[model samples]
Target: MLLEAHSLSFSYGNTPALSDLTVSLPNGATGLLGPNGAGKTTFVRIIMGLLRIPKGKLRVHGREVATESKALKAVIGLVPEGEILVPDITAVQYTAYAGRISGLSSTEAMDRAHMVLHYVGLGGDRYRKIDGYSKGMRQRLKLAQALVHDPKLLILDEPTDGMDPKARDEMLDLLKELGNDHGKDLLLCTHLLDDVRRVCRRVLVLSQGRKMGLVDIEMQGKDTDLYAVTMRGPIPPFIDFLESHGFKVDVDTDGEGQIALSRGAADQFIQHAVSQSVQIRRLVPLRESLEEVFTRLVSKDT
Candidate 1:
């Protein structure tokens, strides 16, 4: 596990920010999904050692968060939510400064700054002042600075908060490459379900200061035995047959049918198909969209 939190809880004076949360994030891209005030930011802050952990236990890279925070800082790079860049400094200068602050030698910091700027697609404009850059460019700059230290894990907070569709897509592709090809573990903190669906392999959903649950985004809403079926022959009888046998059924155009029932019912469904002389051309389980998963989790928590 890259990150492990057990019964983690936090409070802001009288208000609870996190409550008995337990989750483990593995190597690869994971999303910290929640609406505003859902404790996502607080959770990141605690892991980064910016905030005090008054209760529970958290381990980052197998090091206790509260006791070994300094060591964790050396391996965890953070791209914070708000604007933190100096307006007058160029991309290289700012990125190099970040590397230096992370304990890199000035010479090595400058070398890495150039390399990371190019890596983040800022090579052409590496000399531009931060104040003059567009929103997308600034976002990339934050990523470059985060990468300047060459940390093992990258935590990005709302990486695509304000961007056009094209820019958003480009960022997602870049992140995917970083996690998949470059061997970087990434934690994406965002409420946008589409972003998580596209970029993250696993997700931890939080709501109202509590963890709704963690799920592998690819496998979410797949535990149920709801399959989409398409056939070449008549389907009406098959649909009726399923419903009469306590299976939920939905029929569509062109001999498409959807059946929801227990996994045990599969044998029964198959047996019925043979008896009814219906050809089972194709049967695929329907996958729930990220939006559906998020909505279901939040609603159930409420």
Candidate 2:
């Protein structure tokens, strides 16, 4: 397991932050999704060894976090949501310093800093002071710093937060490469459903500091029994025919759509449509979007 928590709970004074959260996340790209105040940040902080394990067992990389935090820090990298860069330093200096903090020697830190800076497309601006860099450049620098240590698992908080369209796409592509080609495990914490859908294979959703759902992106909406069907002509007779034939049909208020039947029913449905003089305009499997899944999960929690 990449992360394992058993009865994990935390609080900030009188208010609760995490409530009996238990989950085991495997090695791969996973998205951490939630609305505001869902304890996502608090969970990341615990993984980074910044917060003490207040109530229950929490382990990372199969080591107890409460006792092995110092050693664990070397194996985990973080791209925090807020800016933590030193404005006066050059990008190389900043990245090298981060590598050194992760326990690398001076020579290795400098070398890796240069390599990762180039990897993140910041080679040209590496010598420039960070204060002069734009928001996108700064975000890239943060990613470079996180990669400097070459940690096994990267915990990123809003990596594309302020980026424009082009920059956002570039950053997402980098994330995909790191996960697919470079063999790095990632925990992407963000509010953007599209980002999760694009890069992550699995998602862990939280609501009000509790686990709401864990979903596999590839298996989310591949319901072989359900399909979206559209047709032209008398909708009432077609719907009646389907209902009478024991097909479950959910029609829209507009009376122009239906979702029903299994793969075996496809031929029969088409034949019936033709017999009823209804044009089979469109028929396909219903694949639910990530946005729809997120909304459903959060709303259920409420």
Candidate 3:
């Protein structure tokens, strides 16, 4: 296990942030997804040891984070949500400084900084002032700084928040490479469904200060098969008939309906249409996207 949170709870003076959240994360890339004020930031703060664990257990790398925060931080790297760079400093200088802050010696820090800069594709611009760097370049710089110490675990919060489509794709590609080929465990926190779908295998969802669910990104919203059916006459009768026959059905006002069923329900659907004296104009399979899955889950929880 890479992370385990059992009954984790936190709050401000009056409002609750996280409420009885428990999850176990394996070694790989996972996404933390939620809306605003869903306690995603609170969870990250607890993992980074910036906030004290007030209620329950949190373990990273099999070590309890509340008692062994220093050890946990030593093995964890974080790229925070917003810009934390010094305007006057260069990328190489900032990255080396970050390495030293992580307990590397001066020489080792410089060496690793150079190597990670190249690895992040910032080798040529490493010496330029961070104040003038583009947003994408700055995001890469943050990633380079986070990787300079070569920690075992990396946590990124809203890494591609402000990026354009092209830059976002580029950043996601780099993250895929890091998580898949570099043997690093990653936790990406974002609300972007596509980002999570593209980079993570698992997703932990939070809503209204509670754990909505944890789901496999690749396998979610796939079990129930959906078909768009258009009929010549009375769709309500057909829908009610299908429901009575154990198939879930919904319809629009235009005599078009969506039928959801298990593997062997299609034969029953055809039988129902024929017996009900309805004409089936067209039937097409509708693939559910990840966005729909996220929306459905969040709406259900909320």
Candidate 4:
């Protein structure tokens, strides 16, 4: 019951950015997931009071957004998609300045700066110039500034966008820790399905500025994937045996190949192959990727 939006709708000229969007987010991380131009940014802007939604109701912590925007901002921390740090400034200096702007004293700001930076996994480089920092380090700096004020809610837009795989994983892990260990409410806006699966428990999906889907991430992730599996055991016959039963299989002599189909098909194929005296060290479902799911959802919505 931390944040709620009822019948939230907005448009620019003849095109709509959000259509009758409605959702209630709890205390944990709630993922606002969709592809580009899906109105995810518009949704965050409305909640952050950056853009006014002429229609519908938006509230934070039982306070009306229109009437208490200042109070609302005091309790909300935003990490935008782009870089927010001063390139020439060190992480400590920028974070301390942000803390002071959030209404902390000089001493308190410095303390909070170190604290948030440490929590964000930049303890050693808290004084490093942001211009020379890695993508991961810069991401951590953005998050550190958002936490300096101790806002009740944190809204992040593509926090790990420019990172390599390892950096992306690190940023995600830090975000998870922020929500769980720090007792903060999170509004995570991203197109990465792995982010949703790894961090947020609840999810809202947007498409073409219309509220297309709202469901728990758990439900979306529950066995709807098929993996390309490999095995080191007696897996040589798995592919041929599966094809003979109309399972549509592709093989690899090294016992590594793909079996693409429905979730039911994957499970049945694995079970049947195992029963046929073929030992499979791995029975992976070529799980549908997040981008693929988003594409399918948008296509179907239209």
Residue-pair clashes per prediction, in order, are 0, 0, 0, 7
Candidate 2 CA-lDDT value: 0.90
Rank order (by TM-score, best first): 1, 2, 3, 4
Query: Could you say which candidate leads in lDDT?
Result: 2
Give all TM-scores, in the order shown: 0.91, 0.88, 0.82, 0.74
The TM-score of candidate 1 is 0.91
| Clashing residue pairs for model 3 | none
Candidate 3: lDDT over CA atoms?
0.87
173-260, model 3: which lDDT tens digit per residue?
A: 9899889999889999998878888899998888877888788876765565888888866677767777777787787756687877
Error of 3 at 58 (Å): 0.8
Residue 152 in model 2: shift from native, Å? 0.8
Candidate 1 lDDT, tens digit per residue, 1-302? 78989999999999999999888888899999987799999999998999999899999888999999988898888888899888788999999999999989999999999999998889999988888989888898999998899898999999998878998898899889889998999999987878887888999899988989788977776786888887655677777777787878777747776777576777787788888887778878888887887888888877
Stretches of model 2 off by over 4 angstroms after superposition: 231-241, 251-256, 262-281
CA error at residue 279 for candidate 3, angstroms: 15
> What is the lDDT of every predicted structure here?
0.87, 0.90, 0.87, 0.80
* Per-residue alpha-carbon lDDT of candidate 2 for residues 1-302, written as tens digits (9 for 90 to 100): 89899999999997899999999999899999999999999999988888998899999989999999999889888999999888799999999999999999999999999999999999998999999999899999999999999999989999999999999999999999999998889999999989998999999999988999998998887665777676778888778888999888886534455567776778898888889898877787877788888888989989
For model 4 the TM-score comes to 0.74
Clashing pairs in 2: none
Q: Which stretches of candidate 4 lie over 4 Å from their true place?
A: 220-296
What is the clash count of model 1?
A: 0
Worst 10 residues of 2 by lDDT: 251-260
| Global lDDT of model 4 | 0.80
